[model samples]
Target: MKIISNKGGKELKLSFRKVLGVAFIIAALICIYFAFLQQEKYIQGNAEYKKIKQTATDTPSDDSKHTQDFQVDWNTLKTQNPDIVGWIRMDPSVNYPIVQTKNNSYYLKHGFGKSYNINGCIFMHADNKSDWSDPNTIVYGHNMINGSMFGNNKLYKSKSYTEAHPYFYVYTPSGKMTYTIFDVMTVNDATVPYTIDMQTKEDFQSYLDTIKKLSTYQMNVPVTTDDHIVTLSTCTNHGRQRFLIQGVLTNIENNNRVGGGD
Candidate 1:
């Protein structure tokens, strides 16, 4: 009887081990399945954006007058989604249509096609004028792991990256604007303030000084209260911190195609 009982206990232990092994395998399979689904979602979102880019944007010819002139067909593009305010491009990595809504949260989950997507489209701050006339226009994007959106934004923290890609272009409905990157920094979201209403020169100058001091490297790019700057913002670590790339408007080429929010 003792021998039979010992044998039964051994069988139970083996059965328990089998159960755990099966559970582990099942869990792993579920994880892979979800990961695959996420990857597929990103691919689909990217395809949608690529279609928009090819359909509505083109490279400027040699005769183009502006250094940063990239032709954008705002008329046709807006028909697809009127929220599109402009096109933001940083060669070899970042290029996407910029969108602005009444609030900033919509584009954080939606694409240019207004479809639900994890890799949301690039967007302007809610308070920013869609015309890009603000003293400091702020742009926001998700730090996608796949290097889409503003995922490469953090790379600007490296002086070498900025040296290689010194400027980024924004094609507004009215013109193509060139912005020279001056500073890149990361700050606690709560510690530093972000504002679109720098009504006074002193206020704006103070804002500029704060960011310049926070910058990780000195590029000696002259920026002052008079300059119209663009701040490209993205998350660093789950939104607790924020990474910013500040660029001062160096040049503007008016194409006379006027269309944007007030």
Candidate 2:
């Protein structure tokens, strides 16, 4: 009887050990799987970045002079993905091609190259015209942990940061336009930034004033309703809230040398 009892205890111990070992192995495999997924995402993002840079640099026109134009090889980009609408470069942080579809949901999971990607592409609000002729052109991107998309945009929450990086550029088929940073604010997802309609100049000016008051940083830049504005918005705190970096069209350089756009 004593021998049988001891044998049973030993068997139980072995079984417990086996269970722990199996659990550890499964946990390790999960870690490895997630690591591989992250690595794959990094590779895809890097490849897209390289392709865009190469296309932008391959213009047959004088490279030095063309740099000033900020001309996008739209034909090539459209060939890859017809959703390609424009490109945006925020000094020292963001340089990305913008995409637009009939709806906003598609690009949240698709790249500018039209590949499924976790990093996603910068996309304009579907409600706005793809030509960027809206009274307020609002663009959205993920606040990626890797600082790839609009992740660095969170830095503008700092007053000093906005002062250092006060402008961003938008290049459309019509022209290259410069937007001067005016307001960086955190607001509920349904606030004026997301829901306002600016049909009249007075309405826009009132909207501007409200956002300016809400801004985390006070910018001396004057914004009138007459100015075409661009709003860069990204999710913060799991989409319950948003961080908006708003800018006014400060300057524009068109192909015909006639600046500004409606």
Candidate 3:
């Protein structure tokens, strides 16, 4: 604004530069406010998961009381939210309850407690059979900055990291399923038909062949057409790009079907 004094009269007028400066300041404050909210949300989301992990999970004692003792208490967890289909765990940091809903978008914005959370939760593809009977099962999570919820999956880009963490487990109500990591790559999400169902053995093999060619690391793990595979996918820093870690089923324990969804 500018003030002009002429012949005992004073007038005020708006200045374009001043107005533009005020707008810039407003925009900056808005950005800062949203950034603060996002950080707080992430903190709350992490805390909630930590609490859930403590309350809804168990570990076998050294004595090995029961061979069939699953790490996750599905009965208790399902009571909290039936959408939680399974649990995924790796040796130290990568551990979370995998949720599934009628559609793919719900869990991407909601946590295990079904609360609004930008950090989201690890979730299975909506089209996938909860029992994991399908030949290819795809899981999704956000590339959280705090290294939670498949954010660590980005580390798989390093061949050494991939080698060091060779296996991860998915615990269903029925049994514990183990998978060996065979391929890791970051690819354009739009081009990859990640949701395509491999109907026939030949089609499955072809799909495997196509992905293996894109792998950053060639870990010598044999994948056959008959085997079941799980694909862990998360967003990369680049827009419309995704990092994937593909694994083949190597082991199954406590095969009896029991508790929770089929």
> Which candidate should be chosen as best, given lDDT against the real structure?
1
Per-residue lDDT tens digits for candidate 3, residues 155-193, read 778888878778878888877888898888888884453
Cα error of candidate 1 at position 27, Å: 0.4
Q: After superposition, how far is residue 208 of candidate 1 from its true place, in Å?
A: 1.5
Please report, in order, the local distance difference test score of every candidate based on alpha carbons.
0.80, 0.77, 0.79
Task: Find the number of clashing residue pairs for candidate 3.
Answer: 0
Whichever of 1 and 3 has more lDDT, that candidate is 1
TM-score for all predictions?
Answer: 0.89, 0.83, 0.81
Model 2: residues with Cα > 4 Å off, grouped in runs: 1-18, 56-70, 256-262
lDDT of 1 at 128: 90
Instruction: Please give the distance, in angstroms, between residue 161's alpha carbon in candidate 1 and its true position after superposition.
Output: 1.2
Better of 2 and 3 by TM-score: 2
**Superposed Cα deviation of residue 168, candidate 3 (Å):** 0.8
Clashing pairs in 2: none
Q: How many pairs of residues collide in each model?
A: 0, 0, 0
